[model samples]
Target: MTTISDTVALLSFLIAHPGITVAEAARATHRSPRTLVEELNGLLMCGVPPYSPSDYIGLTPLRAGDDSPIELHYASHFSRPLNFTPPEALAIKYALEHFSHGVDRETLAQISGLSAALESSLGGKAGAALRSAGRGFVLPARTERMRAMIGKLMQASEDRRVVEIEYYSSHRRRLDKRRVGVFEIIEHGAHFYVYAWCELANATRHFRLERIRSARVLDERFDRTPPERRDAGRMAPLFGGKAKERMLVRLDEHAAPDVVDDWRGVEGVKIKELPGGRAKMDMPLFNPFWALGFVMSLGEHAELLKPTSLRKELQGLLKDAIAAHA
Candidate 1:
């Protein structure tokens, strides 16, 4: 459901940018126009529940195709935009700061103004909440040139342009060049990344922004099917595919108090508390290195209870390490 403020914002934006097509509006609002249009069309059936033609709001699409002009009528109720509540205002303050990090100079100044307005307008606990919230996020310190590169990538995403980049591969420990179709910039695990289709890998990949040595925007246009654009909200796997193995492990309950809590709500990870303060966990093994590191850190407190082959592999790695140290 769209919030009143969100619906109002959409209406206002459409009015300001008259004759704007669905795609253009989608890009500006950071929404899929397909979904935006559904929300817009919903406004037509809404109003005082008389359900009469006069009571219902009217919306007419003017042009053929989705390149249509929307006409709004019987909508005097929202003449004055609504004000945000204290919590909402604080939320906006945080959101503005989150986005201001990557915006250009002009937009950064505008965000600062909006932030100031929110602070002054808020009072009491709301102001405290805003102040209490800190920059809990850490973005890689980027040079001015890198910030400009981010701007170029954003433009390429909206304009469907491909980009050629010289990226430093951490795992390979080498610099490699690739052509990628820019999809979107997203933040995950305290770092910003460019989610794109890599022509070199022929797969969707997320490249950390700081790892890109250089980039050049290409003039050629690209068409991204709905499936091609990956969602940035989820933490992308480092290996770039589905988990290949499932792992079962047991923990001495007294040893790792927060371990169960840490994975409590995660999908595909389940825990069962035992009678003697022991717990068993079953989860998909996204990465063997990650799983091994965690288990090894626990020492005698943790045990791998399933997939004997994986345990054997870990033992082999441990033996190799011991031999090297010896």
Candidate 2:
């Protein structure tokens, strides 16, 4: 969904460069061409008349001899706290506003104190909701300096150079300096993490970027694995385990859409509409316990049509749960 800020940013871009094409806009904004077109359509909803055709593409002034609706003074109003492109910033803001309340408290807390500007703009209700949902949890404010430091760390990681950092680990309650061989930046839920080999620890560890008090790039460099190898390592499971099994299941018509959407991450998952208002799906199981929990959440709408062992296992679990409740 397009936010007011997204619409404003696009309008600002168009007003700045009057005769730019969709492809050009996409490149400038770091957004997909299709997305830029969609954002332009949304601007049309707000009474901005933009012109785009196969040959010539640009936004014309709504009426001649009028100043652009977007003002330079108001530009900062649409600017996001994070280094996200307009659409991504808007999406994250929207999610924090709407979907965060029901999520885990720790997760909500991590996002809550990320930006003071965001908190103030969200106003009382949203702020109160976040605090209420995330009781007894607090996150350190992410200031502009911290963001800048993190950007530098990211660059160092890409260059495969050592980074010296003054870091504060809340759990440890001490500030320390160390050089790190950076591996990857991981976004777990709402938090940003640097997973790297700590020189002090001589082991891989996850460090929250927000907790770094200071950072500097070191002159030393190291040869890192190629992109393909790095990607494969990232894809590997955290826990030692055998390869996941694949299974097939059937869903009732009432459950088809939910199943399809939920199983989208499972590789090779296919859903086919069946007779008598049923749908069949093939799914990959990373861990049977996790898979069973997900399938059981669907209740009676889902049925295991194949893999009799899995069906029997789920049945036994269900029986045990009922017995425990009884």
Candidate 3:
């Protein structure tokens, strides 16, 4: 099956090598000639979101059928080469530098060459940052087993295959086996999640990748469109479902500065400053456990003002901890 990633790579290849035949494009992209033709046809409907006719990535063959060279009639945006803004250039440079650390030496060389070309092309401050960016972010290495699990889930998603997995549930604090129809893998907040239809719960759930103990792709395939995709272009939040509740907290003078510095412009978060360096914050209650941990981290300087139930739970936990220590 030609995955979305493959289709994107195919589009880039077609744009760059515009007159290549189907057979030639297949050879270059490592896809079968038949699959190449199918993907080309699929691209007819593929475009930027809010996809109108003009937003589509247009292309046509120089001659009829799949035998001839292809010609691209891309959207207006693709008409010109990309011109990266200063921040964009810096982000690209930092990404390349970070990625180079995790790749093989041969791949590292290619990344280094690409970085050099970008720096040379975009001179001055951007160019200098690319050369001296020096590890702006560091990522922990993935274990071989975790990498294999991620690869398996990705293939299952592409093929619409069912998979049985041993998952460690943080809420339950135990391992459980469940069968799921894989959808897609998504990265959020520096973590990877496999969004899938869980047979046990009979609901769509995002399973954290790191917590999956093992995965086995079954021979069975799923035929129905994923619930969120049934409406096309509509999907639930990747970090679990939408928040159904809100949290209101009061921050004392000691914690006010940190809260403002950290969440000044974050969406769904509202902060009202008061006299004497205090502030009231209102935000979505995505997870109670996370809220408890966050409030605990802030110690006595932060207080949960609303959601009486959560406030009670926090008091109980604090009492238990104090009693245990005593």
Score residue 294 of candidate 2 by CA lDDT. Answer: 69
Candidate 1 per-residue lDDT, tens place, 114-224, comes to 777766766777676766777644455546665677888888888888899999865455899999998778766556788888899887777889889888888888786
Q: How high is the CA lDDT of each candidate model? A: 0.74, 0.61, 0.75
How many residue pairs clash in all the candidates, one count each? 0, 0, 0
- TM-score of structure candidate 2: 0.36
Candidate 2 residue lDDT tens string, 1-326: 76665566666666676556666767788887667666664443332234223222234423322333322222333343323343444555656654343334444566666644554555455554433343233344555564565567767888889988888854356799978877876665566777777788765666777778778888899454434333322223322222456668788888887777765555456678788777888765544665577679889998876678888988999999999999
lDDT of model 2 at position 69: 39
Error of 1 at 18 (Å): 2.8
On the 0 to 100 scale, the lDDT of residue 80 in model 2 is: 37
TM-score of each: 0.66, 0.36, 0.60
* Model 2 CA RMSD to the hidden true structure, in angstroms: 13.3
Q: Which ranges in model 2 have alpha carbons more than 4 Å from their true place?
A: 1-185, 188-228, 231-244, 264-267
Q: Which ten residues in a row have the lowest lDDT in candidate 3?
A: 230-239
Model 3: C-alpha RMSD to truth?
Answer: 10.1
